[model samples]
Target: MTSVKSSAKAFVSEGALSEIVVKIMDDSVVEFLVGLGFVAVPGKEKETLSLIAPNQEFKVEVFSRLRDEGICFSVGPDWCPAEVFEFLRDQKKLTGFYRKIVWEGTSTPKIIENC
Candidate 1:
């Protein structure tokens, strides 16, 4: 049997690392998601916030895209509560992508931003 540490090392060496940590300034991503009309789930201790999908279609699309990108995420049917559809329908915010600068560097980077 393989040791757990060896297994983890092999996983990392295979470029199959399953998780990533992103540091966003000022919890802006959470704020943006909330501002976009996503309902925030409570009781998180980290800077990250759990958001509920407004409907089944939205949840399916998000999960599909994330799976296609090979990103790991967690979810359950409860993520789309019964009242979420009505809540989303009444929201004034539009559903779409909006780019926000989450990080800034004091010096120039070796890699080009476009790249």
Candidate 2:
């Protein structure tokens, strides 16, 4: 995984209560996700983050930040908690959950979206 040396910008979701928007300052989001203890979903694109589960507090913190920031987006069903993710990881013998990040692809890479 890439190292997370640059700072991260957390954006509040405008409509979505479940998803949170975190602006990745570095070129890669993989590092940021790894730092958070979330892993990429198997058989899926690393960019298309999918985790086993995320707790309500974790969800709320992200969603709330995005909402507070006035970042608008489509809200979906509530995400499962971290415990659930842990269970699935243990049962399925999976590595970890996925964390999505949107890259700007500019000289100074900046994240556009985070899930």
Candidate 3:
């Protein structure tokens, strides 16, 4: 008899923004989020991710929600370069808002006050 090793595959929802909140879960989930256009922001202990809205209208809609919830984030023009912004705009990948969320503290990620 031969013994074989098996690995469990992490399940991720395609094109789901909530999926990106699991960045602290594991590398596989992180990879999946990245594939869906989530940009990883460098942090010390917390993991931050930003998603560029497809257009200005969509950006406003989402940004208003984030602001209401008091989540830590930055708009596109705040962090993105002009050239990159233009490129993403041309590709219809970004608008004026960058929806950024920071998960902080413990193994279980949770939304906390802005850092």
Candidate 4:
């Protein structure tokens, strides 16, 4: 059977609709956090994440070692918060793109470019 993706119009519950809507607005928040170099793995329950950016260079350092975690998080102006991508790009430690290995079933994260 084919998988059904989540749609924008879908609602999980009537009573939780408002919160769900808010969550949708920040759907990419997790991805953005992950892209910044957090070891955000799937199947792990997470309520909140603290992105530790001690310096500008380490802002995106999370992505550098995240490949070992087998994570696939979203990014881009269309999918993620625009400011987030910009912040990650601003960090000299991080390259523009990193490999997504879990769904792609790869052993490495690809570096797209230098920011």
Q: Residue-wise lDDT of candidate 3 within 1-115, one digit each (tens)?
A: 2222222122111112322222233344445445546566567232445566666555544434433433324212333222332344566654443223322443332222222
Q: For residues 1-115, what per-residue lDDT tens digits would candidate 1 score against the true structure?
A: 2111100000000111222222222343444434434333244433443434455555544433322322222111332221232233346322322111111346321211110
Error of 1 at 9 (Å): 16
Task: Write the candidate numbers in order of decreasing TM-score.
Answer: 2, 4, 3, 1
Which residue pairs of candidate 1 clash? none
Candidate 4 TM-score, C-alpha based: 0.30
The per-residue C-alpha lDDT of model 2 at residue 31 equals 57
Worst 10 residues of 1 by lDDT: 6-15
Best-fitting candidate, measured by lDDT? 3
* lDDT minimum window of 10 residues, candidate 3: 6-15
TM-score of each: 0.26, 0.31, 0.27, 0.30
Lowest lDDT sum, 10 consecutive residues, model 4, at: 13-22
Best by TM-score: 2
Q: Can you tell me which runs of candidate 1 are displaced by over 4 Å? A: 1-47, 73-115
Q: How many clashes does each candidate structure show, in the order listed?
A: 0, 13, 0, 4
The regions of model 2 sitting more than 4 angstroms off are 1-27, 52-54, 63-115
Q: Better model by lDDT, 3 or 4?
A: 3
Better structure of 1 and 3 per TM-score: 3
Supply candidate 1's per-residue lDDT for 49: 34
lDDT of 2 by residue, 1-115 (tens): 4232222433222212333333323335555545554444455445334332255556544433333432322222354322333333455533323222223445443322332
lDDT of 4 at 57: 43
Please say which candidate is ahead in TM-score: 1 or 2: 2
